[model samples]
Target: MNKIKPGDIVVITHNTLPRLGVVLKVHKREDPTKDIARVHLAKHNKAYNFLISDMEKIIDKNT
Candidate 1:
């Protein structure tokens, strides 16, 4: 998987349904494998926290 960063569009799966969001912040935990991310969802106008592994970057369809 590619490294995620702020401003990247990602798909978050832990929520009620898979949703698209923009990464806001990344918090690295003591265990490197358990890094967390804060994402902003435009549709809901809200932000949520999730594990980095639970999010996948969105591939540009136009490319």
Candidate 2:
């Protein structure tokens, strides 16, 4: 899996409905392999932290 970078649009699936957000930061935890993604959900006007594995990069449907 490719590492998610800041500024990339991502989809968070932890809710009943998947949310779209822009990644603000990628943090490496003490575990090294356990990374976290900081995302800004514009619709909700909130920022949240989620496991990197729980988010997916949004691909353009036009491509």
Give the alpha carbon lDDT tens digit for every residue of 9-47 in model 1.
Answer: 899887678999888898999996799999998889999
Model number with the top lDDT: 1
Q: Would you list the C-alpha lDDT of every candidate in the order shown?
A: 0.86, 0.84
Question: What does candidate 1 score in Cα RMSD to the true structure?
Answer: 2.8
Error of 2 at 29 (Å): 2.0
Candidate 1 displacement at residue 38 in angstroms = 0.8
Which tens-of-lDDT digit does each residue in 1-63 have in candidate 2? 766888888899877788899899999988855799889998899999988878888853333
Please list the Cα RMSD from the true structure of every candidate, rounded to 1 decimal place. Answer: 2.8, 3.2
Compared with the true structure, model 2 gives a TM-score of 0.79
For this target, which candidate reaches the highest TM-score against the unseen true structure? 1
